[model samples]
Target: MRLVIAQCTVDYVGRLTAHLPSARRLLLVKADGSVSIHADDRAYKPLNWMSPPCWTTENTEGPTPVWVVENKAGEQLRITLEDVEHDSVHELGVDPGLVKDGVEAHLQVLLAEHVELLGVGYTLVRREYMTAIGPVDLLCRDEQGRSVAVEVKRRGEIDGVEQLTRYLDLLNRDSLIAPVSGIFAAQQIKPQARTLATDRGIRCVTLDYDQMRGLDSDEYRLF
Candidate 1:
């Protein structure tokens, strides 16, 4: 990864146009050819970015430096630098991927056994519930005895919500499983994902791993 803090001006042209006036900003160039510009805030959100399948070029022959990024979609981002504050390249090496204390499968098992975590009268009807698309993580029934199809994840994102929506769509088509609803369960759920789920009439449940594991109690049941 290459990081550059520079006093620069930026402009983007494609399906739309955007501009950033001359200001000190951070520029990130990833090994995958993705580029992003960031202000001093907004956490991980970038001011603007171009994902992979893109290329960047830099020219320092002139008094001022110039950088251009172009993606396959014909989008172009041009940066003209007046001065460089700090610049560094980091060799983060190949990542080992993500390591989690408890995997999604484990969470599934725990939730299945402690079905009440879903609601007051909810009960696990089946695990790895089969569907035309794939197996749903958990099949349950709510207090009103409505079929509830659940899709579990370590972190609930839009994709997870989409998966549960697909399962609900297919399941509800069957008369025997008609009127099925969905619940997206995860340890952490993003705000956007929660909104999407709610708009789709799917409930979002944030699971507490430690609580579900009964780590606070010695009488934890693993059945």
Candidate 2:
């Protein structure tokens, strides 16, 4: 990873245009070719970022650093460094990846046991249903016996909706699961993401983790 603190300005042109005026900011270049600019605040969110699957050209031959980054879609981000404050590179070892909590992984288990939460007559075919891409959070059959693919997240974002859409596309290709539908389940879903999921014909479900747990306990108590 390369981190550079410099006085720079950034311009991005693609589906939309954005500009970051000159200021002292942190420029992060990852091993995967992704780059992000960060202000002193906003915690984890970057002022601007270009994900991997992009290419970057750097010209240090000049008085200051200049980088031109382009993604596969031909979207470009041009960064012009006027003055360098600090520059350093760190060799961070392999990442262990995100560690999900009960709010994420365990919720899948609770939802599987109570498939009715999805809708009446919904029966769990399995949890962690395998697909060409990855394991779906839950797979079930609806009231009409149609296959349903549920993607559960702690917090639903646009990407989570996109992911479920991909799984649905792949599952629908299988004759056994053909005509498969999708549900985006999360404790909290962004309004924009919900709108996108709905437009894509995928249902968005807002989950109540504690309430679901309470309902599950009630079922066990009755049994």
Candidate 3:
């Protein structure tokens, strides 16, 4: 992975156009082929980024060097560098991946056991279904045999949805399952997350943690 802190200007030209004026910012170039620019204030969000399966080239011969990042989808991120404060590369090896919290772990198990709750005739393909990025919580098939990737979270928030979105992007790239859908499941879902999921065509299901595990009180039972 390469990290660069530079005084630069940025322009994103694609479905939408955005620009960032000359300023000192942190730039990241990951071994996975992803590139992102970050501001000092934001926690995790990048000012702009180009997801993997893209190409990046740097032109440093002139007074003002520039970096051009392009993807197959025709989107481009242009970074014009005025001054470089810091630049370094690191070899961070194999990642162990995220460990599920207690509630999240339980939710994954219960969802895997009752896959049909996601959709009629849905059958569990596997839990921790591996992808290039990370393991999907649950992989399933709908009534029509369409692929569905589910991400289980204790609390569904924007970051969770973003994680699921990345998984969906990678999962849909498989030729055998070139059109995989996604389901974001959690005990409680935030409004912003739900809105983003809906806009992305990913379904959202609120899990009833106790009821699904047969732990709900008797008075709450319908029968």
Evaluated with TM-score, which candidate comes out highest? 3
Candidate 1 positional error at 205, Å = 12
Q: Per-residue CA lDDT of candidate 3, range 70-136, in tens? A: 9989899999999999999999887767898998999899878778777669899999999877799
TM per candidate comes to 0.53, 0.62, 0.93
Tally clashing residue pairs in candidate 3. 0
Point out where model 3 deviates above 4 Å: 215-223
Best by lDDT: 3
| lDDT-sorted candidate list, best first | 3, 2, 1
Alpha carbon lDDT of each predicted model:
0.83, 0.84, 0.89
Clashing pairs in 2: none
Question: RMSD in angstroms, all models?
Answer: 10.3, 6.4, 3.0
Model 2, 68-182: lDDT tens digits are 9998889999999999889999998665434568679877887778778677688999888887556888989999989999988889998888778867867877997778999
Runs in model 1 deviating more than 4 A are 61-63, 103-152, 158-191, 194-223
Per-candidate clash tally: 0, 0, 0
lDDT of 1 at 201: 93
Give the Å shift of residue 13 in candidate 1.
Answer: 1.1
Model 1: per-residue Cα lDDT over 1-223, one tens digit each = 9999999999999999999999999999977677899999988778888865688888889998888899878899989999899999999776542333467879988888778767779888999887645688899999998899988898889878866876776787789867999989888999999999999999888887766675533333321
